[model samples]
Target: MPRRSLADLAPGDLVDDVFLVASKQSRADRQGNLYLTLDLRDPTGNISARVWNVTKSLADSFESGDFLKVRAKAQYAQGITQLVVSHLEAVDPARLGLDPAAFLPKAPVSIAVLTSQLRGFLKSLDDPHLKALCDAFLMDDAFLADFTAVPAGVREHHAYQGGLLEHVVAMMTLASTVGELYPEVNRDLLLVGCFLHDVGKVRELSHQRGFDYTDEGQLVGHLSLGVSMVEEKLPLVQRLLGEPFPPETLLRIKHMILSHHGTLEFGSPKLPMTPEAVALHHLDALDSKLHAALREIRDDPDTASRWTRYDPKRNRRLFKGSAPPAAGEGEEDLD
Candidate 1:
């Protein structure tokens, strides 16, 4: 039988397909019967699934990043679409002629386009130190390869191959425009900061099997890792430029990386303080939040409803808005 995509599933439809197990958990209901909860995914998107009356051995048998052959029925509840799985078995994706990459999504824009845009932004830098720093990263072939391929996030905004490049390029575009409006804001600093803010994610995330945190990522986090990455490059920049990078400028760049999350509660150890730091924080937040919201609307399986499921993390349901009238149906004759 042919595969059915998670995005195309509707309530009451049967599902028979293979999916990458993004995550899996064993939990018990009030009566204490063990069940399995899974985050099943394909290239298009992911859906939550439940296997009731499961044994611990079965739940532990399949791990995240493994592919599963599932037989299930799609169901909708509380504004979310999920699968009520009847049967599931671990399978070798290779034997089934499935490449793991086929289950991962790619960025909407091509990597070539994104790489060009990033280079354009880096090339636009005027400050000698900033330009040198950006150049240091650009000249590193291995880093460039990962930076262009790693997802901006595991499952949040821009969660696909080449997503980091897309997010950085988009944020740089916003920073350039916003910098023009505020003359006091350091355009070079802000632009560079935007480019480097999430660079650590390239090391923090492993996209080989499925998106998951690396040991360094889980322990040290992207923010700290990002700071280290910059520090590692500073010496190379100095060697190339024949001088030590400015202390104040380095301080600010480090601040921007550490504080881009905006607040202590949000995992940023320090708050955004400098003008460029503040701008980078807000712009990063804006792009990431907007991307997530738009994706929620675009990928919500409950298409019959206008509102997406309540996102506990965001604390609100997105309003999908009324559909546009069909092409010629809404046209008024303008005399």
Candidate 2:
């Protein structure tokens, strides 16, 4: 039987044996019915689903990332497609075979090329403290294995393979150009902040093709995990320098990492209190938002006519083509 994505399924349509993949889940509704939400993706795009409770506890039996063989009542309402779960089972290769690509998102370009650009940024830094920190990770076989090989965010721009390197390089380029405008923004510090802010992502995101969260990510979170990464690297560099890192310099660089997101509501513990901190926050936000706008524009230019909702982190809407003149006269009308 052909696989039916959540988007293709229509209201009240009976669905028979097929593989159902769960991408998200939610709390039970007021009617006491449970719901299983999923991202049903295909070669085209993804569609979301709302599955009502099942007899076998489909929500509990399978998981957010699990692939299940299921029977469903398909429907669509309010621009969303849904599967009312009738029967479901967790899939195993021995029991039910599936094409792995159906479940995971793919990258648009070669990750290796992006990774090389990240290495170039590290090679360019001149400050001793900033250089030490970046070099420690960029050069280490184990850390680079993790850093370049991971995704930058769980669900945002550059969220696929080699996304970490891609994000950092983009941020670095932005920081370099933006720093030029404000002489007060220390270029080296900003570069360091850009490179290390997401270093914890190496530990936070699973490098496997599916790109899931790691145990450390669930427990400590990337902000704290990044600080730990800095702490761990200090000793290695200190050993080579024949003395310890200067305390205030180390503290400031670390502070940039902790505060780069800009506010408590945004998961940053502290607001950016320094020029470097503020610059880093805006630059990071700028890179992600611009990348997202470009991605959305490339995906569908028609979206340009509509004012997209502002991205909370990046703070902007995306639009494409310029509007046509409203009920205008022909071209050569003089004032």
Candidate 3:
């Protein structure tokens, strides 16, 4: 029999499939017996799984990022679908002729298309110094490769391959429109800030297996890493321009990166102090929140419920609005 996809799993269903182990933890139950908790994933999505009364050796046998052949029964609990795993064992993907990409969620948008759009955005900047600074990062083949491939986040919005590129491009598109609406705003500065706000995530996250934080990522976080990255490129930009990059411009850009989170409570070291800084903060929040909300609505398995299950991070259940209109003749079906 063919393996069942995680996304298609419903309550009271049987699941015998191969999934990538996104994460695993061994915890003690009420009686001090060991149990294993895991996040199992495939290209469609992920499910929380539990293995009751498991031994320490069995829990330690497979690590996160390994492929596993799982035997489980699907069930819904705590407002989300999950699996009660009866048995699981690690499997070598290559030996089984399994393609790793099939187990990883990817951006709906094409990476090459996103790359082309990014280059176009860079070319459109009118400020020579800012343009040069952006180019300095883009010209580095190594950084560009990771930047285009890394996920925007681990579990929130755009948590898939090529997600960083997609998020940046979407934010740039928004900046272009908003800049025109608010004529006093510096369009070039805002655009550069959008492109660089999350650039540090490329270094902060390790995506070779599943997305997880690097040691430096856990220690220093993305804001400081981003500022450091900007500082590193300053001398390069200066040499390319045959003059010093403007102090004010550099300060504004770094401020935007450091303050994009908007508040100290949310990890921003400083609040947004400039017009561009304020705009970047709000724009970043808007894009990420909307993406996460939409994803939650789409992924909710309770088709009967008009509202999605409670999300602790979001602090509310999302309303499922009216169904989308059917496609017209010659129109592409979006569903």
**RMSD in order of candidates:** 2.0, 5.6, 3.5
Question: 2 or 3: which has the higher lDDT?
Answer: 3
Give per-model TM-scores: 0.93, 0.77, 0.92
* Candidates sorted on lDDT, descending: 1, 3, 2
Candidate 2 local Cα displacement, residue 46, angstroms: 2.9
Candidate 1 C-alpha lDDT tens digits along 128-163: 999999999999999999999999998899999999
- Per-model lDDT: 0.91, 0.71, 0.91
Mind giving the per-residue lDDT tens digits that candidate 2 earns over 64-118?
5556666667665543455666666666734555555445555565667777777
Per TM-score, the best of the predicted structures is 1
Q: Give candidate 1 regions above 4 Å deviation.
A: 332-335
lDDT of 1 at 242: 95
- Cα displacement (angstroms), candidate 2, residue 319, comes to 5.0
lDDT of 3 by residue, 1-335 (tens): 56666677789998887889988889998899999899999766789999999988898898888899999999989767899999999998899888887777899989999999999998999999999999999999999999999999987899989999999999999999989999889999999999999988988998878888899999999899999999999899999999999999999999999999999999999999999999999999899989988998998877778889888877899999766666675687789
Model 2: how far residue 111 lies from native, Å? 0.9
